[model samples]
Target: MNSHYSVAVIGGGQAGLSMSRLLRQRGVDHVVFERDRVGHEWRTRRWDSFCLVTPNWQCNLPGYAYQGDDPDGFMVGADVVDFLEKYAASFDPPLLEGVEVTRLRRTRAGVFALDTSAGRTTADQVVIATGPYHAPAVPRIAERLPAELVQVHSSQYRNSGQLPPGAVLVVGTGQSGCQIAEDLHLDGRQVHLAVGSAPRAARRYRGRDTLAWLDEMGHYARGIDEFGDADEVRLRANHYMTGRDGGRDIDLRAFARDGMRLYGHLRAISATRLDFAGDLAQSLDNADAVAEGIKDAIDRYIDSAGIVAPAEARYVPVWRPDSSPSVLDLAASGISAVVWATGFHRDHRWIEVPIFDGRGYPTHERGVTGCPGLYFLGLPWQWTWGSGRFAGVAQDAAYLSSRILDARRQRFTDEVSWLAGTPTETYPQVEWWAAA
Candidate 1:
């Protein structure tokens, strides 16, 4: 590939590809570097039954919106990979697959230099669009689990048949944990779900998809300021639901009703036994409270907007016995696999800049980093609640591309003025020089 580019976008996912499309349109010279193939995570990391949590209609990238037949339907894992591949093809982006960017730092000349698997590359500007969820964050207790138990992260999980011939313990109560638990339970495995504090939402509310309601209410457009706390919004857990089973809601209560074992958060794990907290009832109550809050917000929005909507049936929380044991004999339960759906953490160690916050997150103003010409995209709550979603990454990408272009134009103007031995203040109109 090229040794130099005007801009280098790391990661060939939606964010990078969207930026590539916009940069191409603006006559900006750029290249996209991918550690693997485009949409590598969607192609490999996700499970077999995985589908988009969001609707198909919301999968909007720059210049590429969802044109498939089913706007409301959810796309499966492979279909998402195919969509990304087509988007990459649409622009013929200068993407170098199998090239991993190992190091990113500003050189002495004020340009960003990247050390990659292929070779060294330099750029005037760099957009780190590698996304937020970089690596799986399994709890330290995971290491103490019995060696015989097949431990797998949610990303490595593909299908129920991959696990050994026994029950599965799915830790965490977020989307992945709930979906995987449902998957295993449906596949005839006696499933045990360790519950956490994840809010639940009905897939459909008041005769419309919940996402559509959120879109109409501009919930997706809400920024950290709207939430009143950046840390709270950034650290908020995703709701417990799924787009699988044709967008059916995966109620944890429903799981308990279906004869699946429910446990509190996995506190400690010994060789033969696993200890859980006695907060199962409280956890369920918290989930129900949050779920009610969401429904109430929707109700208020409907009333405020004066929209004619039918009353929707409310979901009742599933009740459990108050005297359940906080400890379980893992050996007797025959759980041979442990699925850690504990979410992910970002690893920005390679980035030599000091823009990270106290939580190790890159500090940026809607994608532009504190360091000039350095940017980030596909970050959660970067600009809004939807910033990390498939549709929202492109919005950040488009905004950042404009910033890069503005800086590029100014630099070109300065160069022309300096070459002509004219003062930049006097020769501000250098359109002809830029064109030439």
Candidate 2:
């Protein structure tokens, strides 16, 4: 292998693979560093009957599309891995598998240095394509649950068959939690779903994908700079539903209709027991209230902006029980399993770059950071509606590659001066809270 490349990509998932392919096509010398086997995270996903929320038509990498007969059809988890492998193979991406990047720092000569298990390497540019879903964010309250309750993060969950045979309490209302609850309910596990703010559910309107419509209508595609402040974009984006389509269309509603009890956000877990904020009816009411707020926001946006958005994008109503149940009541229900599908957090302690914000996320514009030659791709909502999706990665990759090429052509000298006493490179140091 070459001692260094013009660019080094620090992931090998769909994003990294796609980015590497684009760079290769541009005749840019680049190498990919993958900590595990190719598509390792997808292989370990807890979903059993999991399918891409996005249609297969949108599953294309930079230069490859889903070659199967069903383009509009959703792909199963295994099929996704296979598709990614094929994509990587087609591009002949220079991938170093099982090479974990332990540290990333800037050298004195204005090059990025990467320390990996394989060895140290230097590159003119670095692309951090490590995805948003790399780390699972489990709440601290999980420790309070009894040891026998079989508490697990959604990442560890596979299918209902892998779960303990009893009533299950799913502690999130996100896509993963809803799908798992539905699956467990169908498998005959008395399932109870703890609803946080009910998520905006995806629904098809007319004959188009909701996301496509959103993108065309400038819902998510609008830039943060286009809006006055980041807060507005964040709020509007939060109102947008995740990729989950519908009740019958997706699995969450099916689980509810099939008799999965719904609860509010988990308050506490007592000895083999769980406590909810309110009764199911009250929880459902709370969910309804949240949905109403989202609807109002969407309506206001349409009314003020005069944008023709999807009409059938309605929020699914939570299953409202005729009789409300009591809080702190689980023993009588026989709930034996609790799945935490809360979400994920980014941990960049191993990255020695000072460009990261206090939240540990890299502070970057599109892909370029304050530090020259340091770039990021595949961040959630990095560019537009398609930013983080498999299909969307190629566009960002092409754009970033062009930017890098432009920078190289400009021959711009490094304007940011290094501190006099500061070391040229630094080792990975754990953040204070992370160490605790």
Clashes per model (N, Cα, C within 3 A)? 0, 0
C-alpha RMSD between model 2 and the true structure: 7.3
Model 2 has a clash total of 0
Question: Which candidate wins on TM-score?
Answer: 1
lDDT of each: 0.86, 0.71
State in Å the error of residue 100, model 1. 0.9
Write candidate 1's Cα lDDT for 31-113 as tens digits. Answer: 99999999899988899999998999999999999989999999999999999999999989989899999999987767788
Per-residue accuracy of model 2 over 78-133 as CA lDDT, tens digit each? 88888888888896889999999999998776778888998888887889999877
Model 2 score (lDDT): 0.71
Q: What is the alpha-carbon lDDT for the whole of candidate 1?
A: 0.86
